[model samples]
Target: MNKPPQNSAEMPDYLKARRLHLNGIITLMGDMKKLNARANKNAKVERLTIDAIAAELDLIDLQLKRKCG
Candidate 1:
């Protein structure tokens, strides 16, 4: 597992940017999810993307939790 910065101040620029990008993706995914639900479409691609992003966020959260706790 990749180690996170010990603190917010210690985080690198790239990681910060990455987190922001991923957060934006999450927002867009939310819209896509809502649209898919309304249209009753089988959004396999969207589902896969959501799963991948969730997995990545979970990993990052686990690392951050370890650093903080």
Candidate 2:
């Protein structure tokens, strides 16, 4: 009989951190989407804030992949 493959559930601290960071980025993106839907064109500040958040999320995703890989 063949044994089941091992899971990465036992990953190290760094991997865990990366996973958490990725989750945070996703959550932030969801929030930004909601805000964008309600925000009017005159809301320049809100648009800028959303743009910054998106940039940060991209950076975090890249960092997480680098660290986890």
Candidate 3:
């Protein structure tokens, strides 16, 4: 059988997955930003969620920078 994913649980493109992931995070952040600007937005929860997603994106960036050799 083919080798299973080593870097992520669902994504198999180890080398380029970060770009994909960052794009997704960026999209999510944009949506959250919009929500935060709305009248009914929960400020505290939005702040926490955005912070968590940002941290996860940073980790993905760090992983992408690691040498494969």
Candidate 4:
């Protein structure tokens, strides 16, 4: 069976921004998961680790904005 295509909603600017931010977080999380799987202890504490941490923080901020605004 074939699947139906998704429709694009006319979302507000904030919602669009939130979606973009959340997508970025998901991508970052996936990258982090891969890094954690393949990397040793030293790599875990590198710049990529810091980037993932910052991405998590940004995700939290976006979530809060979504909830509060």
- For candidate 2, the lDDT comes to 0.60
Q: Which model is ahead, 1 or 3, in terms of TM-score?
A: 1
**Model 1: per-residue Cα lDDT at residue 61:** 67
Estimated TM-score for each candidate = 0.58, 0.44, 0.53, 0.39
The list of candidate 1 runs beyond 4 A from truth reads 1-9, 12-17, 35-42
How many collisions per candidate?
A: 0, 0, 0, 0
Instruction: For residues 12-68, write the lDDT of model 1, one tens digit per residue.
Output: 443555666788998998887786777656677777888898788777666556645
User: How does model 3 fare in lDDT?
Assistant: 0.63
Q: Give the whole-model CA lDDT for all candidates, comma-separated.
A: 0.71, 0.60, 0.63, 0.58
- Over 1-69, each residue of candidate 2 has an lDDT whose tens digit, in order, gives 233225544333544555466567668766776777865565676557657766766775675567467
4: Cα error in model 3, Å: 8.1
lDDT for 52 (candidate 4): 70
What does candidate 3's lDDT look like per residue over 1-69, in tens digits?
A: 345366453543553565576568768877867766766556777568767867877776676556432
Clashing pairs in 2: none
Instruction: Report how far residue 26 has shifted in candidate 2, in Å.
Output: 9.3
Ranking by TM-score: 1, 3, 2, 4
Q: Which scores better on lDDT, 3 or 4?
A: 3
| Candidate 1 vs 4: which has more lDDT | 1
Q: Give the TM-score of candidate 3.
A: 0.53
Judging by TM-score, tell me the better candidate of 1 and 2: 1
